[model samples]
Target: MRKVNEENERIKRRYLKYLKAAKRKDPSTVQKAADGILKFETSTNYASFKKFHIEQVIKFRDRLNEEISKTTGKPLSKSTIATILAANKGFIFWLADQAGYKQRVRHTDADYFNMDAKGQRVASAVRESPYPSLEMARHAFNYMPEVSEIDQRNKALFAFFMLTGARDGAVASLRLKHINLIDGCVYQDAREVKTKNSKTITTFFLPVDDEYLTCFIEWVTNLRTEKLFGPDDPLFPPAEINVIDGAFKVVGLKREIYKNANAIRQAIKEAFTRADLPAFTPHAFRKTLVKWADTHYPTRQAFKAFSQNIGHSSVITSVSAYCPISIEEQGELIKKKKKRNEDD
Candidate 1:
């Protein structure tokens, strides 16, 4: 069987470039769009984009419906299906406008790639995701052992996350200079840190338990005084591994930054597991912080500041995306409002 069509590959490259340069999509989003197009090409046996048809879309949808997820070993989810279809649909629509393919592909035929109304609803449903509460986060931080350098670093990392709801990518790339201990703020300079959308963010240390701030301060002091680390040194450096007893083992801290957030995530997972709590991703901390903000900063100006602290441009983005009220909490709020109305 033919592995790939040269014409299709050329068109795909152009489409990906358009997504990045014109649509201003991030790398991950562009990669997803690339994957979606690849999957559609595979389904069509590497057919050229000019050969795109409504029947081909219908057949591809059927194939995706019967496909299984490699990670979960289950059937493909409706959301996953919808995402893949949407990518292909967008590509087909664009192809219809292109010079060479304009006569071959119909603009309206791209609409056939869409899932039914019921399927769309299922794909777009807002389901609650599990995140550690503030208490649970504090418990996890307190439980993290600080016996060794690695242990101390891990504990500090957790405390830092609690103190400022910065994303994992930003945390992984932070330098000592970026954090102002006196000001109690983290300057996520996009030029130096791997921030989301390359956005520069100034995050003030959130009002949380004092213990978390104390832990982080001590860790930074140790790095500066004991380890002789400079301002440019990583806030949380990677572990130095050496062969011990004919086996590779982590011995001490390395004076280098992490290549990515994978190590940071593992450390967080281990810490939570050690604390007998569910391992939550660093992003979950944002949700916890947003929820905390909702209760403490009820006023619009205060809430907006809190949102901006977490790198959100708008308060609505923070509330709609992160601080979803639980069903139980929603009911209690409504009941409280009813009592207030009756009193008035």
Candidate 2:
């Protein structure tokens, strides 16, 4: 069987470039879309996408539901199906409008990619996630042993996340110069940092009383004054590897930030696991920050400032994305409001 359709691959590449340059979708998004198309093609044995049929779409939808995740060994999730279907739908819709295939495929055929109503609900449903509370985050930070460079880095990683509530990618790309202790903020300069939507924002230090922020400042200062690292040096450098006798050994750290956020995510997982907590993803910290702000800051201006700190243009976006009130919590809050109304 043909491994891939060259024509389809070429057109897909063009579409991906369009998504990146015109649509401004991130590389990760483009990659997921590309994977979805490739998976569909693979299932069809790389048959000409120009001759795609509604039957093929129907078959793929059913097949996707039956498929298991290679990593998790569990059935593929509704969210995963949603993304894959959306990708394929987009590709086919674009192809249907282009020359050569315009006469063959109808744009409406793309609608077949929609999952059933039940499936769509499952795909779109928001579940109450298990995120670490601020207190647990503080405990994790304090529990981290800082005897060696790696330990210090791990401690600093947890500390910095608590202090700034910055996304892992932005944190990974930060430089020593990006932070100003005097200003008590980290400026996520878009040109230098991998921020969401390439947003440039300043994160003021959180009022959380953990001194890990101080430790982070001390580490960067020592690296600059004592180690003679310049302003451009990575804030969180890579682990140092050395040849000890014959075996390769990790001694301390080398001056380099991670090329991406994967390492930081793994380190976070390890930290949470060691703290005897369920593994909460780094992104969950964003939700935690929002939850914290909601409890502490009641004024509209305060919420707006909180939204800006997280690089959101509006509070609505932040609320919609991160401030989902869990069903149980919603009921409890309603009961309290009712009780207060009765008293009034």
Relative to the unseen true structure, what is the C-alpha lDDT of residue 214 in candidate 2, on a scale of 0 to 100?
Answer: 81
lDDT of 2 by residue, 13-58 (tens): 8889988999999989999999998989888888887778888988
lDDT against the true structure, per candidate, is: 0.91, 0.86
Residue 147 error, candidate 1, Å:
1.7
Off by over 4 Å in 1: 337-344
Q: Clashes in model 2: which pairs? A: none
Off by over 4 Å in 2: 341-344
The candidate that wins on lDDT is 1
